[model samples]
Target: MNITPKWWHDAVVYQIYPRSYCDSNNDGMGDLRGIISKLDYLKTLGVNVIWLSPVYQSPMDDNGYDISDYQDIAPMFGTMADMDELLAEAKQRDIRIIMDLVVNHTSDEHPWFKEARKSKDNPYRDYYIWRQPNEDGGVPDEMGSVFGGTAWEFDEQTGEYFLHIFSKRQPDLNWENPKVQEEVHKMMNWWIDKGIGGFRLDVIDLIGKEIDKKITGNGPRLHTLIQEMNRATFGDKDVLTVGETWDATPEIAKLYSNPARDEFSMVFQFEHISLTWQHGDKWSPIPLDLPALKRVLTKWQVELADEGWNSLFWNNHDLPRIVSKYGCEGEYRVPSAKMLATTLHMMKGTPYVFQGEEIGMTNVAFPSIDDYRDIETLNFYKVRTENGVSPEDQLAAIHVNSRDNARTPMQWDDSANGGFSDAQPWINVNPNYTHINVAQALDDPNSIFYHYQHLIALRKAMPVIVYGSFEPVFEDHPAVFGYVRANDDVRVLVLSNFTRESVTVDLPESLQAEQVECLISNYTAPSTLAQTVTLQPYESFAVVLPA
Candidate 1:
C-alpha cells in the first residue's frame, strides 16, 4: 500500500476565509465557532488539511492581514479559548489546521511598532526598518506601496520614515535584527506547542528587502533567512510549511522547498495565476492565454521535478473565482468546474479547494463601488480614476479583477443569507447562492461537489498521482489540454476540453488502439482507445493506458 506518513504529499487542503465562512453567533461575521460548526461538512468534502486565513488579533484594515498581535485571536473572530477548541475539534476529525503567519509586517498599532516609534533610541527601534528623510526632506525612496502611493510612511513625531510594502497601516518588519528573528521563531514554536499543524507564511519571500525600498522581493539574504527560520522552528517537527512567494522564479523557489535545505514543504507561485493581467498593472484586464499558461505550468512541473515541490491552486482569498474567470460560469458551470478540478488534481502536487469552489460558487458583480470592502479594490478605483481613467473603466476593471469577488460568504443553502447566518453577513453573498450551494449539491448526486470528492479520493489512492513523471500532451492543441503521468508500471492519460465546443484529441502512434482502463471521466468515454477521440464540450476523461 506504500503507506508512508507524509500526508501532505497527496492530501487535499481546503482554505477558509474566516469572516465569510459562517457566523455561529449571528454577529454578521464568521468566527472560530462558525468554523467548528462546519468541520463535519468539510470532512464530508474529503479534505484532510484546512488552511484558515488569519484570525489573529487585527485592526481589520486589510481584512485581518494587518495584525496587531500574532498570538491572540481577534475579539471579532472569537477568543483564544475558541481557537483552542477549534484545534481540538479539528484534530478529532482527522484534519490538520494550518494557520496564516503574517510576519512580514505588523499593524501600525502592534505593541512592537508602538514601542519602536516612541524614539530612535528605544530598544524596539531596530525591530522595524526606519530611515531618515533625504536632503530634500522628502521620503527615503519613491517606491510605491502594493496598494497605492509611496512605500515610505513619514513619522512626524520621530522625524523619519518607515517602510510599508503594503498599506500604510502595515509597517514592514526588519528581518536583519536578530531579536526580531528570535521573536518570530518563538511565536512559531508556541503555535506548534499548542498542537496546531503548521503555518502558511504570508508574503514570506518579500521579507528579505534590499537597501533601496524600490527594489522589493528575492533579495540577497532570502535563502539564509528562510533556512534559519526552518532550523529554529519546523525543521525537526512533523509540521507542514508553505510560503506565499510573489514574483519568485523557479530557481529561487527550489531553495525554499528543497528537502536538503529544510526550509518549506512547498511554495505558492503566481506565474500561472497572473496570466490574465499585465505583468505590472492589475488594472489592465486581458483575456487569459491558454498556451502561455500551459508553458508556465509545464515549466514549474519540469523544473521542480527532482527538487522542491509545488502548491497547486486556482482560487484563493486574493483572486477571483476560477470558474467565472477561466471557465464558463453560466451554462457550463458544473462541467467546467469539474474539468478544472480534474486538471489540477491530476498534476503531481497538493491541491487546494477554496470554500464554495466544490459547489461551483462563482464571482459576484456588486452594482457599485460602495458594495466592496477590499482595500486593494478601493485603492485601485481611486488611483486609476485620478490617473485619467474614467470611473466606468475603473469599475469595469475592478469587476473583472477584484479580490472581493472571492471573499463573499460561503453558500450553505437556499435560505436567508445562504444559511450562513440569521443576520446579514459582513459581506454580501452572491445572489446565485440560491441555486448553487452545498445543500443543493448534496441533494444532486451528479454535482461539482461529488466530482471533487471523487477526484480527491482518486488522488489519495494512486501513488503515481503523487510521485509520477509529468509530460504534456497535445501542447499545440487549441481546445484540448492533455497530459501523461506515468511510473514504471502505470501510465495515466488525461484529456480535458477547455472550451464549450467539441474538440478532437490525437494520440501517439505507439499507444493507438492499446488496452486501457477508464479510471475517471466527467462523461462516458468511447468504447476503446484509438488514434483520435472526440470530446464533448467541457468533457474531461482520464484512463490508464496499456504498458
Candidate 2:
C-alpha cells in the first residue's frame, strides 16, 4: 500500500454537540442559529473541520441519534434554512462541516418504521430487521439492547420481533435488504450534494450485523457493504468519512480505511478508551491505567502507519471530560489539560478536540438521578438500584463515568448558565463554569485554549507532525508517557507526566540528539536536551531533535 495525501491529513477537527454548545433563543435548547453565532469562535480556535453531531429531524429519544427524517432538520434545532445558513457560514470561514450519519437505526416515529409496524406485508416492513417468534412464542433471540432490556421488541400488528441493539425506540435497519442499502446510499449522496464536508457514521459497524447468528458488529459482510456504499456515495469526492466502530481491531480497521478498499477515511476504534472499563463493564469504573493506555495507543499508531488511518480523540459527546478522567481537575487542571492535549495532538493522526475541551471542561456530578438526561445513565441507575446497589454508590459511579458528564452546557463565561443560554438550559451547567470557561481562557495566555490553538497551528506548519512514524519511549514508565515521531527531515519527542508528582526519566541513546529545541510545552522547557530530565506535576512538552 502507498500513502496518498488527503486534505484532512493535516486538518484538525473540532466536535460540537450543538444541543449543549450554545443557545441563541431562550427556548432552553440549542438551535442552528446558536452554532452560527459561534462560527467565529471556532475559527479563532484554528480548527479546519467541524464535526457536528446529529441534527436531523428526530423524536429526541436518543438526543437526535434516532432519526425520523433523513432529509429534514429537527424543528427544535431550527429549520432547513437555518442549516443552510450554517453550512454557508462555515464554508465561508474555510471550515468544513461534517454531519453525523446515524443510519444503523432510525427513530420508531419514522414514517418507514411507523408503516412497517402497521402490517407484516407493508413494503417498508423489510426495511427493518424483523423475525418471527420462536417455538415458545418468545422473543426471536436472547440478545439485549445496549441501553438495557431485551434487544427484540415485539410488534403486535405484525406478530414479529424487530432487533433493536440500542433503545427500543431506535429500531436497527436491515442492511441485508438491498432496498435498505439503496435508500442509505441515496441519502448519503443527497447530503454530499448539499456540499457538506463528510460524515461521522454512528455505529456503522452494526449495519452488517447477522442478528440470528448473534454477531452485532464487524460482521462478515461489513466490509462488502461499506465498500459498496463508498463506491455509490462519496468515494469519488474529496470528503472524509469516519465510521464509529467500537469493535474494530487494528487489522479490521485496515479493511475499512485502506484506500484500496474504497471504504472510509478512518474508523474510531475504542481500544484505548476501553482501558478504563473494568472487565469490559463501563459502570465498573477504575483508575486510568497509564501504561495500558500508552500500549493501546502506540499499537494503533504503529499498526496504522502504512496502510490505514487513525482518529485521535480523548472525550467526545458520549464520554466523561478528559481533564476529569485522566487528568486531575483540582490544582493541576490547567497543566494537566494542556498535557493531555499536547500528548494527543502530537500523534500521527487527525486529532479531534471535543466541544469545551479546549477550555479545560471538567465532568459534572449531578446531585440526583433526576438531574441526569441520558437514557443510558437513567437505565443503569434504575437497574443497579434494583440490584442491591445503593443510590450513593451508583451516583458515585455516575460522577466518573456517565455520558451526561460530557453533555452539560458549554461554559462560555461567568454569567448564569455559563453564558450558554439566557434561559434555563435543558441540562444543568457545571457549577465550576464560573472559573473554567471560554471567556477566562481567552483572557489568559497560558490557558488550555491557547495550547490547543498552538498545537493546531503546529500541525498545519510541520509536515513531520502529520506524517511522522511513531516510536514509543519510556513504554514501561508508570507515571510518564513518552513517544517519538520521526521523518527524514525531523524527529519530535513528546513527553507527559501523568501523575501529580515530579518524574525523572533517562533518555535512551537512540533518542538522544546533540541538537534539540523545545517546540512546545506546558512549562518553560530547558534550553537543551540532557541525558536525564525531570518533569513537573502534570507537565508536558514536545521537542524537535535532529533526525
Best candidate (score: TM-score): 2
Give the Å shift of residue 329 in candidate 2.
0.6
Q: Could you give candidate 1's per-residue lDDT for residues 1-547 as a string of tens digits?
A: 2323477998899999999999999989999999999999989989999999999999999999999998999998999999999999999999999999999999999999999999989999999999999999998877889999888899988999999999999999999999999999999999999988899999998888885645568888888999999999989998889999988889988888888877999899999888888865767878877777788888898898878888899999999899998888999998999999888899988899999999998989898889999999999889889999998888888888899989999999999999988998898999998999999999998899999998899998998889899999888777888888999989888888988999876788855655678777888864478898888889997888878
lDDT of each: 0.89, 0.92
Q: Which residue pairs show backbone clashes in model 2? A: none
- Candidate 2 Cα misplacement greater than 4 A, ranges: 513-515
lDDT computed for candidate 2: 0.92
So what's the TM-score on candidate 1? 0.98
Q: Give a tens-digit lDDT track for model 2, residues 439-498.
A: 999999989999999999999999999998999989989999999898988888999999
| Per-structure clash totals for the candidates | 0, 0
